[model samples]
Each structure stands twice: as structure tokens, then as C-alpha cells.
Target: MEILERNVEKILAVLSLLAISLIFVYIFKNSDASIINWDEEKVNLNINDKVYENLYIDKINVPPVKAGDVVTITKKDFKLSDNNENLVFRTYGSTIDVFLSGENIYSYGEDLYREGKTLGRGYHIVKLRSLGDKTSDLVIKQRIVEDMSYRWVDFFKFTSSNNIWHEILINNVFGIVSGIFLFSLGAFGNLVYVVLFLITKKNNLHLSYSFATMFFIGLWNCTTSGIIQAITGNYEIISFLEYFSIYATFVMYLFLVALIKKKSGKTKAIDIVKLLSLLILIGATALHLSGTLCISKTIMLFRNYALIVLLVLFYTLYIDYKNQKKYENVLLIGNCISFALIVVHIIIHNFNLTEIMDITNDNLITIAVLVMIIIPLFLYFLELDEIEKYEMQIRVLKSLAYIDKLTGLGNRTSGIAYIMDLIKNGFDYYIVMFDLNNLKEVNDHLGHDKGDEMLVNFANCLNSSFSDDYCKKIRYGGDEFIVVAQFDKVEDINDNIKQLFRVIDEVNRDGEKGYSLSVSYGIASSKEFATTGYENVVKLADERMYSYKSEVKNQICET
Candidate 1:
């Protein structure tokens, strides 16, 4: 029955993990941080022979206004007739129109401009005003009105490329799937650690660091997609969300760096890089929001550079993995290639260069992203098992090297290494050498077993007294020990030695032992050694210990 219960629990755990993984995959695949923007609007105008040869305005800005609002065409600059007949103009979408003949101008809607219609072949600007109670703005688009003799150039048509739309959809779909897979792979490592912690009842929260990193990634993607969806039709909203997500992406990368260098305390470099990327994103966003359409178009060029950074990261990871095969960070490489492909699609669309590769412009990149999500997810699962085995080996090796076999205290080699580190770091410290008063006598009288007990007890006392304090205790030899620590003055060192002696005296007075466990301690400080090496200082401490033992012997003889 107990075995059945355990099996059921295991099944439940597996099911829960699978469910969460699927949900995460769904979120990664379906989310997007892009808004829909309307393609340019086009209208056709008929030109009469009389006024079509005169002054023309190419574009105009018309704000939201109610009916009967007299729209003004501020004699805005216009292009000459395409063939010396009609002029074409791009204008803001308002509910108004302007009549132009030479320098003559009048404002009205579809009616007044009818009079100025002439045998011209060019574009003209017209303002618009609303006819209803509620005022609304229009997205002004270019229109071409033709006359009997209208030139071919005057027959303007604004067409948005369907190819661009297809490319965006395909690239984005692929990207989404791939991204989710990569994320899931990374999460597998954390899941393994979390399960181990649960089974052992140990607070091994190391995996939480990675979890926090991936949680931010998921959060950022979720926030970006929702914002993009909400701002689909609002220009201001779209502009704001674009820059926000771009900056957030950089911040996420910086956070990842922090996770990798857990203890380096060099987070400022990450902050600086994040700040620069944010500035670039903000600057591009601002240029887009301003009236400069060309500058807005230029931002796609900057995005190409960001893609380059992703490539660099991919190669760096590959190099690291070569040196240390343990790091199979597949997401870094998978996402890099996925994003690179998407960028290629973008470039092809922007420049009409589709001959290089069999690139599809129908959500192919989106699908690529989706596919990438699986790479991380599965890779994470594999990495978790490898990491556990590696950590186990490390623990075993460390135990052999640093732990004393007899008493479990720090071993002689570890003690020497610790002191060497302190010396290299220029720490002024005190070394207290402790020797068992009569270990040979105890061994001769009570056999090696009793002597071993005395040694164990002595080691335990050293560990108990100094382990929780400022001192580090080590089993220096068979019947010798040492305590090392940084001290401000010799007086502090003296007080600690006196406390050690008092503890030994108390133990002896209590009886019940074969030869009371007592130690003769010698203290040496860096300050007293002046220019001497650590070896010389240790020798001095040992000599002092013998002198103290001699005094104790004399006192015992008198008694």
C-alpha cells in the first residue's frame, strides 16, 4: 500500500510538470509585441482643364474638428504637375478640402475643390473636418484625381506589399515556438533542483536564481504581447509599447548576466550596457513619433544591429561550451539563428532582395521562434541530470581533500592552504599552536583506543570553542592542533589563549578521565614577527609552547 501511494505521488508530480510545460509553451508561441498599423489610404480626384495647371499643395495636416469648421490650407509647398498638367499631393486626413488656382485658395469639402479641378496631372493636398457631433481625426492618405489628359504619373496608387505581411507572420510564428522551447529547456534545470530539495528536505534554493531569471523573461514577453495587442490601432500606444519592450529586452539580458556571475559584484557593467541600449531604443522611438517618417524607417536598420549582438552571444556560448562541455546552452544558439533568419527576412522585405534564400514571407519567422522554445525546454531537462552528477563528484572530492579522517576537523593541508591565502591577501593575523600535554603517556598507559578517545575529545573541544567564533581550528598533527584568525591587537590574542586554558582546567577538575585533556598553547602574531616569514613565526610559537610546558612541569613538581 505504501509503495502504491509513492507511485501515485510520483505520477501526480509528473502530470503537474507536464501541464505547466504545455501552458508555458502556449504562452511563448501565441504572444506578440507588435501592433497593427493601417496602410496608406488613396483617393482619386478628377481634374478639369481650367485650374489644374495652377498652384498645388502636396500634403496637409488636418486635426480633428466638427462640421462647419473652416479648414485652412496654409499654402503648403506642393510638387509641380507630373507632366505639366496635374499635381499630386499627400494630405492629413481631416474632413475638409481646399481649392487651389494659381494663388487663389478656398476651403470646403468635396464641393469647392470640384471647381479647381482642371486638366492637370499631379497631386494636391486637402484638409478634412467631421460632419457629426463627435469630432474624430483621420489618417490622411494620398489620392489621385484624373482629368481627360491626365498623365500616367498623375494616376497614383498607394499599394502596401502583401509580401511584408506574409514575412512578418511566418517569422514571428516560428520565433514564438522556438523561444518557448528554449525557455522550457532552461527551466528543466531548476525543476530538477526543486525536486531534489523537496525529496531531501534541504533548503537548496540555488535553482531559484535561474527560475527568477526565466520568470522575468516570461513576464516581459507576456507584458509585451498584451501591450502590442491593446495598442493595435492607437499610434501613440504602439510607439510607447515598442520602445518599452525594446528596453525591457536589454534589461532582461543584463539580469541574465547578473545571474551568471553570482558573486562577482560587478553588476555596474550590466547596468551601463542596459542604459545604452535603452537610450538607443528611446531615441529611435522618439524619431518615429516625430514627423520624420524617414527617421522612423531608419530604426529598422538599428534593429539589424541588435540582431548582431544576438549573434555575438551565440558564438560566445559556443566557444564556452567547447572549453567546458557541461554548458549546453542551446537556447542562446537556437534563438540567435532564429532571430538572424528573421532579420534576413526583414532585410529582404525592406530591400526587395529575396533571391539569396528561399525565404517565405508568411509568418515563417514566427514559426521559427516557436520551434526554438522547444530547444531550451528539452536542453534544460538534459542539463539537470548532468549537473546533479557533477555536483556529487565535487562534494566527494572536497570531503577527501579538506576533512580530517579521524576527527572531521579541518585537515593539516587545508589549514596550511588557508593560512597561505590569508598571507597572500596581506591579512595581519595570530596563530595559536596547541599541543596535547602528555599524549605519549596516555597511549602507553591506556592503549591506542583510549588515546584515540582523548584525541577525539580534544579535537571536538577545539572545534566547538573556535568554530562559532572568530578563530578557525585545524587538526595540525596526530596530537597537535592550531587556531588561526585576524586580530587587531596582541591583547585580544592573549585573552583567547587564557580562555582556552580555563576551559581545559575546568575539564580536568571535573575528573572521570584517564589523564585530564589539557593543552599547552603558544601564540604568535604577525606584528611580533616584524619581517619574518610565516614559517619562522610558526617555529617561534612552537618554542614558546615548550617553554610554557616547562613552567607547568616545574609547578607540578613543587606541588
Candidate 2:
């Protein structure tokens, strides 16, 4: 029944994840949108003051133009069916102005350009309205800065205001949801760490690394989702976050890898990897900030470098697994899967393959990265399981150490420790020493097993006489026992001794066993023993117990 319930729970959990994934797919896929590929369309380009007609946008073989040069693209005989619709074009590396039939219609960054200002390196959206003409000429003039290698305009389309809003929401839904989910999970992980730290007062390195990695990855997802651009409408801020997130994510991942290696006690190789990763991150950040490298181009280069780092990390984990480091196995499996997915994504991305399930290969790689982040949480739980097992074993060993196997009383080792603790804490206690009388006679008459039976009866009588709250009983050694009782006065110790005699009498009267149990005892108070030390007090008690045993033997001989 329990197994069936557990299976049901597993099925429910899987269903929940699938349901959420389908919801994300639905939100990201359902939109009435169109993309006009410039590669397939006939366009004309004016590069470096030279005009080339009937050229494919992708096949344009113009020389690279210097900074401050002008480039124009003219698409003649263009037809417009909806005059009210907006024509949106995404462009890079230019300040653009749209002209319809040689008349100015829309200008992008013209005001900022005239003010001798810059919006920095980013993609800008240029929008213009149609003239309701069946056939008209469209001219796009751009003032190019830096090299013209990154200059391109594509995804041009006529869309209504409502349709445009739907397209933005649909396109960015996956990113926004994924970012929020990853960030929330990371934050929750940090919260759990805070709670555990408060309870255990130990810093856990894995949790820290997992939190940092997820946080930066979440930031990258949000920035790349396009939702930030849609909400803030600030391309500069979005662009900066986009580039910054890339470096931040890489740095945090390196830290996570290094931490894992450190935990495994194999840090030299990962430390080198961490140093190299940091250098690359720093170098990329410097180049982007110094304007020596554009954001898009820098990110492109970094991606290839990152792939190498990932491969190196995978190899390291593989080596660890080969060494039979059980903890590294999960990491190896997760990294292998993520690496395969990322490789496939890189291939599809580089070849410009068609997207599946309305998700680009880039999005697929993001999913794989998320899987990597989640794997650590599973490992953390596995570590917890091992810790719990270790604690259980320690508890069992502790039981064996302190408990007497025969009498179920505290053992001799624990008795001495208890006495020392009482002395150390200045606790006032009465030490009672006992020796079983005639145990050898009982063993000779019946058997050693019968002697053990008498010993058990004596232990029971001792337990019945003293409550645990005020007294502790120890099976000190063979045919001997010791009990420590806390009391304010000597009269209380006398009263307990009287009660002990009564309990022994009752046990003998019951006659459950063939022999009657008898014990010789001597008591010593802490007040008398404090000046003589607890160990000396125990020796004094042993001497007094032997004296009492001689008295009992004499009384037996006379009777």
C-alpha cells in the first residue's frame, strides 16, 4: 500500500512538471505573427557611395565601410495592403531614417545623432507607416559607426498594434516565466540554507554555489527574454544587462565547479579552470566596456570559449567518476546530458536550422542549463541522506558504549564519568556501593546461569528501590554494583537504604527464582568526600562495603 502511494506521488509530480512545460509552450507558441526574411527577398544596397541592385541581403558582397560612412537599402516596387499597419524593422550598427518614395517618414536615433550623442552598441527597432500605395519605393538610410560587419536589418513585417503586443508577449513568455521560476527556486534554496545554518551553525559551500549560479543564470534569462526591453523600452539598459549577465553567469558557474572540486578534495585542476574563467570574464568585460569589442560580437566569441570550458569541466567530472568518487557520479551524468544538448543547440544555431516546438535551439540550451542547476539540489539531498545514516550509526555506537548489556544499567565506564561530572559540577550526591553475597555458592549449587538470574533479581530490586529522577544505578563489575543518589540530607540517604532493604525482602518473598538475593552495601556522602576527592571516596566506600560483607557473613555463621 505504501509503495502504491509513493508511485502515485511520483506520477503526480511528473504530471505537474509536464503540465507546466505545456503551459509555457502554449504561451510562447500561440501568436499570429509573420517574419519577412531579407535573405530570400530582392533588395538593393548602396555601400560606400556605390549602388548595387537586385542583390540578396545575405549574398551582398560589398567592401567593409569605415566609421561615419553611409549605407542605404532601397526596395523598389514594394506593395502595401494595409495603410494603418506599422512596418517594424530591427537593425544593428546604425542610426536609421526611413523614406517612402523619397519623402521622410520615420527617423531612428536622428535626434540623438544630431545632438552628438550615442546610444552605444545595440539593436534598434525602426517603425514606419505605409502610404496605402500599391507599388512604391522604400529607402532606408543609415549612418554606420564602427565596422559594417555587424550591420544588418531583418524580421521586417507589417503588424497591427494589437498583433504587435501579442507577438511581444508570446515571444518573451518563456523567458519571463523561466527567469522568475529559476530566480524563485534559487531564492528558496538560499532561504533553506539560512534556516539550516541557524539550526546547525555550519556554512554549506554547495548551497552557496548553487544559489549564486541560479541567480546569475536567472538574470541572464530575464535579460535575453526580451521582456525587459518590452517593459522598460530602454535598449541601453537591456543591452548592458544582456552582456553583463553572460559574464556573470560564466563566473558563477566556474565558482560552482571550483567549489565542487574543493569539496571533493581535488582542487588543483578546478582552481586552474576557475582562474582561466575569471581571466576570460574580466577580459571580455574590459573589452566591452572599453568599446574595443561590440556586445554581440563579444558574446559570440565568449560562447565558443565557454563551450571549451564546459568540455573541460565535463572531462574533470568524468575523471572523478572513473576514480569511483560516488558523489561525482550525479554531476557527471548531468554534465554529460547538458553538454550533449548544448552541442546540438550550437549546431542548429550555427546552421540556422528551423526551430522545433516554437523554441529555438538557444532556448533548448537554456533548458539544459536549468537542468544543470537543478542537479545540485538532488545531490544536496543525497548528501543529507548520507549524513542521516552516519548520525544513526553514531547513536547506535553510543548506546553500546554506555549501556550494560546484561543488567541494562549504566556501565562501569559511564559510572566513573558520571561521578567525575558530579564532582566537576559540585553536585551533592550519596554514593552507594553494593556487592552480591554468596554468588559463588549459588553458582556451585546450581549453575553460573542461576547466578546470573540472582544478579538480575538484585538489579531489579535496586531499580525498584530508587527512582531515576534522584538516583543512577550502574553495574560496576562482576557481582558488584554502584548507585549515586542526589539528596539534601543524610536522613534521605538512610531512608533510601531502608527502602532498598524492603524491596530486597519483597523480591525474596516472591520466590520467582530458587535463590534469595542478598547484597552488602556502604554509603558515602559528598560532604564527607568532597575534601577527599570522588575517587578516594569510591575507595573508602569499597572498604566499608567489605566490612559490611564480613558482618553479614558472621551473622550467617552464627544463625
Best-performing candidate as measured by lDDT: 2
Each candidate structure's TM-score, on Cα atoms with residue i matched to residue i, is 0.49, 0.64
Q: Write one digit per residue (lDDT tens) for candidate 2, span 274-333.
A: 888788778766765565665546656765866787788787776676664577588878
lDDT of 1 by residue, 343-408 (tens): 766665455433432235324443343334334434445545565578789889988998898888
lDDT for 217 (candidate 1): 41
Give residue 122's lDDT in candidate 1 (0 to 100).
Answer: 14
Lowest lDDT 10-mer window, candidate 1? Answer: 147-156
lDDT (Cα atoms) of all candidates against the true structure: 0.49, 0.68
